[model samples]
Target: MPYVEVLAPQVPNQRKAALAKSVTDGLMTAFGVTADTVTLYFLPISPDDYAHAGEFEPQGAGQRILLKVHAFRRTEAERRAAAIALTRGVCSAYGVPGDDVAVYFLDRDRSEVAHDSKLASD
Candidate 1:
């Protein structure tokens, strides 16, 4: 299972839908994973609660989105492709600059994950 977490400011439901589709498609294309196996969670952060460089509201500070991708171990090339796809999707749907987004890949072992009351390794 590949789980993706998107942390950024809140947006309209339509934008969320588009982001979900884009990320899912990107994962499928880059990771060879089925749509059903991909999972995404959106976490909205309030603007007031965010600060950068000790500034409450930094001027020209575009939206900073953090994407945490968790999945079974994969090659560096795969991670790079996925990162590019994800960044493109986020920039397109969220209307944010590419420099404003950050992506982190978390590699896991099948035995480290559990689903439906069973370990993924089983």
Candidate 2:
């Protein structure tokens, strides 16, 4: 399976969505699949969204993380497992510590995806 992430500082929601679409397109092109079949997850957070070192400090200097996951399963448990694995992979890939990265798995069902929409639902 292939997934992607955009780890950056706090940005506008439009930028966040655009990044999601771009990464989803990249994943589709990389995996020889259609964008409709891919689910791009954007985990946008501010410096206050998490707690660091037992204090409400910035994580990795307030680095925002976007996690994209591809999971095929018949049950919720398997889906979550795949998601967790994907999060771990993204964390490792960006050299962002697992404890520092905030993971958000955006699940886009094929039904909710539309031609002119990045995602009908978050």
Candidate 3:
């Protein structure tokens, strides 16, 4: 399974559903996971809560989206491909510039993740 967390301040509510679908599809394709095995979470933040370069973001800070992906360990090449897929999916879904979307991947062992009161390794 793979978990994707998206934090953004500029994403419009009307498009969130589409964005989620895009993210799920990208993850499934990139990691060869089933749709039900991929989890997508969106956390919307206010400008007052987000900052860059040690300054609070202004009203027009631009369309910025941050993605954090957690999954099983993989080769560097695989991780790189997944990141590209995620970035393209987000940018295409939200109509944001590619540079405004960033994707970070974290590889974890099965023992490090838990679901439904049980660890993945269990």
Candidate 4:
């Protein structure tokens, strides 16, 4: 299972739907995983709640998205592909520059994950 958490500024529900679909498609292409195995959670942060360089509202600070991907370890190439996909999804959905998006891969083992109260390794 690959769980993706997206942290970004609030947007409309339609944009969220588009982002989810795009990201799921990318994950499938990059890791050869099925759509059912990919889960996405969006955490919207208000502009007032986000600060950069000690500035609550940084001028000219374009939209920034932080993506945390939790999944089993994969090759570096796979990770890179996933990152590209994620960035593309964010930029396309949010209309932000690619440079503003960041993807962080959090590698996990089967034993470290659970589904429906059952351990993945079981």
What RMSD does each model have against the real structure?
1.7, 7.7, 2.0, 1.6
Model 3 agreement with the true structure over 7-121: per-residue lDDT tens digits: 8765666677777777787777767778898888888777667677777776737647889888998778778778888887787767889889888888899899898989999
Alpha-carbon deviation at 40 in model 1, angstroms? 0.9
Better of 1 and 3 by TM-score: 1
Give the lowest summed-lDDT range of ten residues in model 3.
55-64
Clashes of each: 0, 0, 0, 0
Extract clashing residue pairs from model 1.
none
Winner by lDDT: 4
lDDT of 4 by residue, 9-115 (tens): 88899999999999999999999999999999999877656666666664436556899999999999999999999999999999998988999999999999998
lDDT per residue for candidate 2 within 1-119, as digits (tens), equals: 23445444555666556555555554544345576666554455555565545767655464446554543222565445544554454454455566544545445565555557655
The CA root-mean-square deviation of candidate 4, after full C-alpha superposition on the true structure, stands at 1.6
- Go through the candidates in order and give each one's C-alpha lDDT: 0.88, 0.51, 0.79, 0.90
lDDT agreement of model 2 with the native: 0.51
Candidate 3: global Cα-lDDT?
Answer: 0.79
lDDT of 3 at 36: 94
